[model samples]
Target: MSELRFVVQLHRARRLHYDFRLEVGGVLVSWAVPKGPTLDPKVRRAAFKVGDHPMEYVAFEGVIPAGTYGGGDVIVWDTGAWVPYKDPDPGAALDAGELHVELFGEKLRGRFVMVRTRRDEWLLLKKRDEHAVAGWEPGEHPLSVLSGRSSDEVKADPEWEWRSELPAERAALRLKAEDERTRKAEDERTRKAEDERTRKAEDERTRKAEHANDTEHANKTDHTNKTEHANKTGHTNEAEHTNKAERSNARARKSADKHATTRERMGEGARASVHERGGADAGAPGPEREHTRADERERAAESAIGGLESLRNEAGLDAIGENGTWEVYGRRLRVTNLGKVLFPGRGDEEAVTKRELLRYTARIAPTVVPYLAGRALNLHRFPNGSHAPGFWQKALPAHAPQWLTRWREPGSGTEYLVADEPAALVWAANYGGLEWHPWTSTVDHPDRPSYALVDLDPGDGTAWEDLLVLARLHRTAFEHLGVEAGAKVTGQRGIQIWVPISRGPGFAETRAWVEGLSRSIGAVVPDLVSWAWEKAERGGRARLDFTQNAVNKTLVAPYSPRPAPGAPVSAPITWDELDDPALRPDAFTIRTIGERLSTHGDLFSPVLHTQQSLPPLT
Candidate 1:
């Protein structure tokens, strides 16, 4: 005896059934189970044995039409070899009413047992062991070895039949049952419609009765009012009085009618006026509604304005009063009393009088001083001797003393401190000498006063390379222009180049020339360099930063202390030291500059106001 094999083609019929099948004697034994196969061995599920399908039916796939008996796409749900445990033969298993087989399907795998519960019903249960989980969980299925299609497309073939013999007894009983269901459905619909019509009719009748009662009451009141009016008139003669009374009653009624018409006209006029004003009707809101909307908008605007004011205050310009000005360095300003304060340039051209300057300072004091605190700016001071108060002392406590300088301008009788110097230069021979007073004269060569401050980062090899390339490029460009250029080590990896120019060119032009020179250098070394602004791009190559020339930006004054990234000041190193690669950029610091100043006075002090001639750019 050989094991019986079976395969069932399931349409599922819909989404909720299982097409049960078994392979026996090379053909698929089939059944359709509404509840599907159960894992509980004790549960007997009804399974009607369908006629066997051809072996090729295992691959059949297509949609079935709607409203047809057992209509659905066909799918091979399960298939595997099987052998009866009782007799070990195909026919013997049917006779014994029990079967055992190893099953395989899209969602079902491993051994299963089917035992007959009745002549046409059986219980199919999964054998739990190493191949099964603790309980049967939905959607757990092995790959469909039988269907060879996705589980989502699994269906039962519409043509598959469960039995060849027609059960006349069962068909007759089912037909009677369906007829009874149709009758019940029709009765339910009729009853619902009748109930709705009755409800509507009763409501209409009740409303009409209420209207009739209201009309009768109104008529009675009108008659009583007419009688009262007639008695008040007091008619006398019989016939004449009767006529008068009738005429009086008619007049009374006419007057009442006129009054009613007037009231109605007034109401209509009022409604028209409301509509013209865009007011709502009886169901609409009034004028207060519009007021509430406006109020909301006003609050929103106020909130936005408040935020803007707070931002302005943070920028430190909020306190600069209108019509007030201050002398910053040597420039004079005249600020109007408005949001944007203006600096109106030097007053009288010969330098503003101290009295006038002081008055302007006092006017803006309460408003501008708070914002000026802690910000660094240039300041000039008068020497300790001779007449008027020293420039430093006269400026008052509002000015910081650190930036003030004392010096006398050429051809001036009185010695005065001037903070606005074009350049700071130290002759190489003099080294620590201060007597040269290189910047004192206003008539010196224009090229003698300009300087360059290069910020360098030597810790990065690439940054150091970039600095060297820029230094060389700058040297070449200036040499081409016939400008006298001097280079010195910044005491770190960076170098400073000084180009002397006359005083009259102003800081703006001087900065422009520097920017032009930087650009020229950038053009020559595009690969290893770029401008500072361009360097901010992602993965950008390093370049010279030209914006450092903008007005109000002060470079560290020579001999002035600066805190370098992490180290002491390199001070002013000799030109030779700059060529050495070992020098680090972090050698400069504020502490080092202070120490140098105490020991050597200021090396850059003499160069403060030396007049230099600036030739026109060629």
Candidate 2:
């Protein structure tokens, strides 16, 4: 039989420990070694048997988001092949409560025996062998042999780039967007450089022609003609200037060429590394199922575009009345009751009409779409205007357009209108969708969330400043764990914080972890924050709600237009702004928010791209 591969990982979880895993039956049979490995044969380390992990996890070296199972930073401390000692049938020996294995590793090289003390726990002992020394230190080599990164380094930046496989159509769409952005930036740079070169060339040609004319005049005219001779002297002076300019241009060209060469060399090296890592196939066709599915989605997208085109031709500009026709995502949207005022004019504030609402959604779509796109949207419609009572609508309305994408939560069988395209947002807004709440998870994986969200709701006695204080504490706590969180105004009297994380651990795990985190924060500052679910027991402390972590639960998305007075938006704020004493939750109104976005350009975008895993709290 072939020798089995083994790995000993140093896991800095809720408690610092070592995990010893051996390849058995195609999986890594794992055990938690609390005290870690020792070279002394007399000393025994308590090894608690744990669940089997996939073989691929042997190379994993990153943070597990706080709400995930065994959420913490893990690094491969020792790894190598293991040989069975005496007992050829290691499987039988393991079942009999005694198994001997000789490890050949960088840090660990010796014969070890594991004796079962209980069904779930075992005692790991070093055998008295030639390789055994008087003392062995587990902390001697603390960094990972593969990455050369320490546990602290791994925790600081958990750069986990691998995402769960997305639907081929979605993947292609995302890739196309990224390529378009890069191409646009490159084109702009090239255009400017070309313009500069053309101007310089024209100047050089004009100077050369003038010099030739001056020379011709000097050679043909009499030598005694002072005017022509003077012109020749002037031409000579111009020639010197031209030569200097040419030399300067040559130096500039040489410098530009050198930089270009360096960039090209770097690009070549990057491409080679990508090729080695199997990223060279990024442009190639994916699996047959992905291809077939992608084709179907493409056809659907085409049909949707066709429907929009037909509508555009039908609704001519002349045919529009108070109900104006606006084109969005290539779709002509016929907005009716444009004169209908959603929010009445108050004092200096002008009346906000349905037309303005539609306009706001369209204007903010560029900023809003990045956060709301792919998320299952829960529409809060106010058909009779915001003054009247509005109701939440999770399901797509019966009158919803056929072109809109629908999302059905797996297993739950709950269907929702997905704002996958920009047009959907306009369509919903036109239908009186005043408030847009999107689930933390996306349509691609409804069950797995991208963020672990915490909602801070202050009690009656608590003031807005208290909320700020509590938010800062939470931020510091997360920073201590080496995880960065994003804070945003809820457009109400509260604040919300989100930590972007991987999507493998479901809601249950995340919720439990968040609850524990909330309690810990509450414990630290009992006067400021409370983990109580009920307002009665909250005792006026700010309640940090972790309940929004459920799969179906939704949060008011960033840049979403709230139905508050002045139509304030739920805006993301920098951590530095959190300490501002004058800061208020609804300070960023719809009228002023556009300017903030233009200046900052989506501060919360990193929360979508940065993958941070939650390390088990120390």
Candidate 3:
């Protein structure tokens, strides 16, 4: 072999990991070792096979812009040549699910054995050799062999350019953003240092005043003693003693006043220093500082939604008129009845108007748009207040904008709106759309769905607590099937779970599979679940509605605000929250969803990316 090269890059990205690669077939066949390699022969490391990279990447070390693959810092930790120990060509052996190799890298020098455990999964074992150490850890030596720089150093330098995975323009924009963030942090540090300097100068001035006072007191004592020696020595002694006592008292008072002043200044400085932190009182003392930070965090959470809550003074803006043209995503939209209230005020939540609804939809577009994209949508419109009346709009209106994605049903020839972007969502919301329901399937393949559905609908007489138990059962069933699923509050009286899959099965097959899974789960706890089509027959149990997998059938899209009381939103929840006694389907409303999104970003985002398959039913 012509000097087969290998490289192990210590990647401190979104998470710390290592990219282990070997040059083969003019490309770098790579594997991701999360904890990095160890020399202990007894230790077998897990390696997940990833896509091949170009040979040019062997010397690559730099910062990857956020949102890109392995977006963070990278450093060439170790690199050298490798030779097949047992097989003539390592490539053939790698394909055969086992490979024996002798590494001659800067840090790693040993005979290693690699064996495949599953597709894209492998075990790398260090062969017992002279090079093997008992407790070899990766981070003990973090400097890159190529640049002698750590991953942290690489991330801090703008010159450590990002690779071309992102478009040049977008990448440049991201680089600019990074520069801005760095500049802001630097500015904050400078301000903090300046505050410290100011406080120190004040203290120095106070100290100087105290020194001056002490000098004056000493001079007075010296003059009094000289006068006593000159005349009336014995008579002046008692008077001199009284004067001395007065001088001592004056000095003590001055010192006390100066110290108190200094303490007050320091407290003020501490407050000033943390003013911009938004979630801390850095100047506080001991446990007070800790408690202040916690309080500030709670306040910060509230402040995050300040804009949402300040529904006051919303009327006076030409930015949005009762009826005016608004441009969104390069499309001009004419919105009417901007001040018309669609949802009445409930308790602490302010009444939601068409304008406010449009704003909320636009604000949340980035998080919600992915779920709506590529799918035909059904809008539930409430022109009047939600308490008054509402109706579902299935077919797209003829007057709908031409730019909007339109899909024609195969049989009825009725067209549906495919809201695949922010503008479309805002436009729909402006038209009295309260609840948005996107089909489980997309426009391209209406039959093959990428998500299997499970809607836990609480029937008559079912307590909210019972649904919680039933939801837990669903988690158990999903785990047993070895599929990843995401849960969400339906904003009404149900919980919706969506399992992202590698689409191959048609809607019929997917529906059947979900139904089977639901049936099995129901069988486990018959009292808590209902499979009965009739509402009264179920005796108030939560129904696992798997029928939503069919074509044209839809559930309220996540983050979609329901027209029910409190303007509740269909919000995403973590799987672990199912067992939480405090979990409530109605807790997340339009007023609070923003803060949740800010604190815990897109909890259900994995549903858009996780492509795990449910093992075939025997």
Candidate 4:
């Protein structure tokens, strides 16, 4: 191009930064600079290449709605025209990591060099030519070149709405940092509310006690006055003893009643571990429980009664009832079809029932809920048992209990259930949902992935040893990329390597990074790592999958029960444990997970706590 446009926007976002853009290849190649550019060649400013912006934003200056990515006020700080120096193609030079340009604009003039030091990182330096000043600061020229107004002045104009087509990705670092702030704020609010309640309780108790004391005082005073009358009679001593005892008993009764009222007012939630009415469902306000077609038809009468209360009344009457109430998280779970076998026995071993699955789910809730909470779930339901054909449940049924969280995608009209509490997980188990696959992204940040997954899916002829080798190779790739990754036996054919990333990358960026990393790894070990999308073309090799990085795509959560035999779990493990000759995909089952988790705690805790960012690996 003969001459291209360039502009710099003073962005007053979560942080006050500057956005530098240059017209290249029909888009504005951009970089975010924390500190504005300096004319001194000695001072090299840091710039992060965010991405491209459409040409429509060349003169844009206004506020981006709050809660959106890059939600802030902006001003056209500078406007200019630029031409590449000597080089015919500026795009080719940028790709080569260096670009020399000459500016002929109202404010900026002379040659400047933009050098790429790392992916998404660059250094802008003044070339020490005719326009170079020894100690020039961008702050010296703060007014917008377009509107002749400062950024603050531009922001004050409320009617100027930003309609730029550049949709920025939500910054994950901001969310991660806010985690602490949000927690502290919530804790403070909770503390204050509890304090206020305690103050009220104390005041009520004091008032009641004072009233009782006043009554007791009045009775004692009356008894003293009667002493002189009783003295005239022969039964004076006996009468005095009886009168004092009666007063003491009356005082004791009043105190007991006072305490009972307080306890009643506090309720089960106020007093921790007080899951009252063990046989009665407390979450009646929640959505009605989901049931199979057979269940609905068979228990129309019970369904008419709403939920649980009818079953609770029958709890005392039946010796071996089909439905039973279990107290979980202060809610009475009226689990039905308790004797329904989900996992069949291989030999003399007894088959696993729905009752057993419910128990395990309640047992593992504390360990597994962290991974499931806040994420929209895709449940693998085996309602008729694992042997029967199962289906993946995305849209939550209308009858799903009100307590289970539901998310309706912004535009898609699709509703998804979220596992938020212990009761929620148990409810799913009762609904015959065996396998849990949670979205890679949480509900709060729907399009931003928290972790990048590398699913090692083996072909029909792939062996256990082959998987082991590939697992080691995965470890090498993680180390080479300088990222922290954890291994989990997928509870089936392969092992999954989970790389937790800090908040900043969108699904697109995350997917690109994962795909590039996997492809690079595949190149080194071509025979072992299959790149073919179709299974038939893989020729029995393990396929490295990065496609799971997309939004709504899910991987089985750690400690989740699989729909496979023996009720195996997707168990997280240390890398050293993978080398054990006896290690198999099905080694960790529900029977053994409770003890293992009890001993080791959560081995996958790092995946949630430790986050890293990898360089370009493709």
Candidate 5:
């Protein structure tokens, strides 16, 4: 058995290529690949085959001379034992233009095929299925690290060299070519440096010219001012004074002219100096700069016009056309007539009369739907005319109607049935329900149940101090009763307090509890607060609307539009904002409440699902 070892030195002539070598058949086979051997099965690297080296070359390691062809320190990137598969003849594989090998090294262990394309070119491919990892990319496979010498290391180490024993004729030609390449590279660097210097000099020249122009303008302004002062005064001595001033001015003008001339000369000299320094007009603005400025102005003008139009629309004095009339909570409302025209005809076509339309109007009112408490009903006529003709429409009743009915006390507790129309039902379901809002049901969200809502009438000229006192008193009463209470601005002249509790003992029980609490608090704070069942008449005290304690009564969600009381809404508020007398409900609305909720998930969320003991008010 014979042991074969050899080393072939390689130089990747390109600045970005890698040098590779391998020992085979008592000689070193070398290749120079721009991109090193890729373990990726898809990529075949073109490795140019250089001539071989004798077996003794395996121990050769040293620096090649600088300014010489392939001058650098040579380091062994990889050393390994290889088994070549081929015909018995030593040069048989080379002549056949094909080589097969299984390499085993410290870093690389794989089966590879090197097929010669020409006298000096070959292709290296990994037998991906046999030896490389399945689905491996070049850098992903650990075995690919065999091409470990990075490009940076090769460039940084000047002593690294590729020592090849080439024929004398080839060596001479390679040396001459390397020297020429070096000279050209140095020349290019010098040219770039000169160009940079020229640019700086030109900029200096422009600055000097601008400075001289500014001085000349100042001198001309001084002359014009003196002439104006002389003409302002009219007297016998004016002529004498003007003559003396003229002589002095003439001397000053001559002196100024001489200075101006000198400045012009200095500027010219500066320009000459710039030219001598090889400076060009590198400071001139490019076309892109002007386009950028124009774009900015156009955007500003567009923004201004949009803002003006928005302000005009918000002023709201536009044409008030008749939309239609809708009755809500027994109150008649005149809305846009568009709703009636759009209404889809339904039921036996008696052609709905105006009075019947009024009934429909009352039925679809925003407040009435909740009162229906989720009972399915047929919409014989639509106020909006959007529904299909004769289509049976069911009111979105309360998911838990029994709870709402029990809480409202339809006949006994409170006149919970304030209106019979669908509109009244919607309003009651939304504002007067066991769960407060129909959309948010205690049955659905046991974790964050809503509370009963009430609106109060704070009479005109009510002092902020008085309102605060009433709020504090009510808060005290709620705390004493062991109820979890929170307060907020009603977006109007009153304060709204929310009591959080679980749906225990049904809605009637809760309503009874709240009513008792409110009456007791009102009696205790009579000087500051009054519980008036009816609207106040003239200079009467502000009234605590006890009717709000009724079950199934809802406060609008923090941002819903309230057409009454000037389109205000029940807004979620910070404790600080609630304390401010100037803050109105208009500042809050359903549109703006989401942002606050995201930061603090419903301030009353914790008490919603909790049960509390309602102590009798002291």
Candidate 6:
């Protein structure tokens, strides 16, 4: 008899059952077998005749939803070809009441016989054969022979609709990746094009400069020839002609030099332009572009005139006892009496010099400039030494460099120093800037402060612990209104808490909000905190000086060095640190603050970024 394709599907419906299918007449002649197949010669399993199913059902393995026909998990248990035991026509024998077959499968291999015991009911028995054993069972191997999936895995398979979207999702991700590559390539191409344009422009400038130099040389040569001819032709007396020719030659030399200088300047301009565009300066002249002695001195008198390396070198070049000019980041500033102690000796310590102050400002500029930039400076000038009395100058001194940006007050006509960049800070240090106090508002919005400050000015009896408690109370009030507040040690004897707010509200509105917040805090700690504006009414409690949020009022900015003996900074602290009992006002000083900053960058940066509104006052 011809061997036919056979499949055994282990199906799990309300009860577990095995579907035995044999390919016959272009369809699968199916039967449902409970207790599964057995290879034991003595064992017999009950089988119920089922209707014909599609031949393709041999490979199907998945979950069928509940309430559907034969709804349950189904998996292909075993599949292989089978041959009739002895009869040539097994289909005719199957119709005749008894059918016998030799089975070959991953899990079932033996001589099996099916005999009709009743209407639509048959007994499948394993015959005594070489492949049959006394205790062999198919139920011991429950996984699908095709997919290795068990009944539970088949049951948990997701719906086909959801699984079908994976290919499309993968395609979209591939397209997005390709688009990003294309965009990056386009950007590189555009950058190259711009670079090429800049190079061409620089080449043009070089050519023009060279042409101008050549013209000047030619004109000078012609003038010299004319003067020599006049001397030889007897057109004028020899002595007088010689003197005139000398003067003419001098004029020609001056004119040629002027042209050469102009050409050099043109090349410099081209180089600067290229640098600004971040393009290659291949055509730029090298060390030959060094400024003349006059230009050098002029620039030195103006600002520190160099890059980082140059600044570092110039910083050490000056003698301590002399007045000299040095370049710092391409600007020049004059420093006098580098050896003179700006701050006198205290206890076992010696003193801090003017140069030390400049170096400190230069060293801290990268971090300090951002805090001071765009904010008007109230300089605490200590022209003598730190021990001597220093005066506060709201207006920048007349000697301030022209490069320094200044903000003019509305009615007072006071021009305040604006440390717009690192160089400006260096200039301030040259002007004996011992302490930096920046206005609450920036130059962008002088009347509208970016944050409201609650300066905790402690009375004689007010403890540091009480100030910490008050700071927490302020934070609580701010959080209740959905605002984020930061705390900082004042570097002096007190503390300040700051809440970032939207810039749309003027200082008046912010001050009012601060006042409300202060009142709420005062009510919470009535004995320890005071909201009264007057210092006398604080009853030895810490004053919540909300007036510091007014338009022109300022608190010591974060990271700003105080003029104290140890150069303590007004350092920003996390709320957790603020709550620590060991947190001291003088914990972070200039000497140690730099290391902390390198580890934790700009902790108070949120003050310049986050925006929040105050809740309506009750």
**Better candidate number, 2 or 6, judged by lDDT:** 2
Q: How close is candidate 2 to the true structure, as a TM-score?
A: 0.49
Tens digit of per-residue lDDT, candidate 4, span 222-305: 886677777866657787776865563343334333422432211111111122323121221112321232233233323222
Q: Is candidate 4 or candidate 6 better by lDDT?
A: 4
Using lDDT, give the best candidate's number: 3
Write one digit per residue (lDDT tens) for candidate 1, span 322-432: 332322222222223232211112233332222322222222222222212222222222221112222211111211122433432121111222333211111100011
For model 4 the TM-score comes to 0.50
- What TM-score number comes out for model 6? 0.48
lDDT, candidate 6, 1-618, per-residue tens? 334667898888789899998777667788999888887879889999998876545545566557766777777788655667666687788888898886655566657899999889999998875456667677777776544557886577521111222332221111134454676567556556444543455445546656776798879958778768877897657678668655634533343345224321112432343345443312333464424322432333232223434344333433223555555655755566777677644356656677777766776666566668888887766777767766555545444566889886542233578997887887876777777778777887786777778888898779888888887676556434445566788777788877766666776567668878777778877898754433454567777776565544577767666676766778876555654555688766655665455434455544554445555755
Worst 10 residues of 1 by lDDT: 426-435
TM-score of 3: 0.49
Give candidate 3's error at residue 608 in angstroms: 0.8
- TM-score to true structure, per model: 0.26, 0.49, 0.49, 0.50, 0.29, 0.48
lDDT (Cα) of model 4: 0.67
Once fitted onto the true fold, the runs of candidate 5 whose alpha carbons sit more than 4 angstroms away are: 1-455, 506-508, 537-539, 564-567, 574-577, 590-601
Per-residue alpha-carbon lDDT of candidate 3 for residues 347-462, written as tens digits (9 for 90 to 100):
87678777777777766765677789988887888777688756566656535666888886542233678887778988788777788988788888876788888889899878
Pairs clashing in candidate 4?
172-503, 286-402, 287-401, 287-402
Q: Which candidate, 3 or 5, has the higher TM-score?
A: 3
If the candidates were sorted by their lDDT against the true structure, best first, what order would they fall in?
3, 4, 2, 6, 5, 1
Candidate 2 residue-pair clash tally: 2
All predictions: root-mean-square deviation over Cα? Answer: 47.4, 24.3, 27.7, 25.7, 40.6, 36.8
- Provide the overall lDDT of each model, using Cα atoms, as 2-decimal numbers: 0.38, 0.66, 0.69, 0.67, 0.41, 0.64
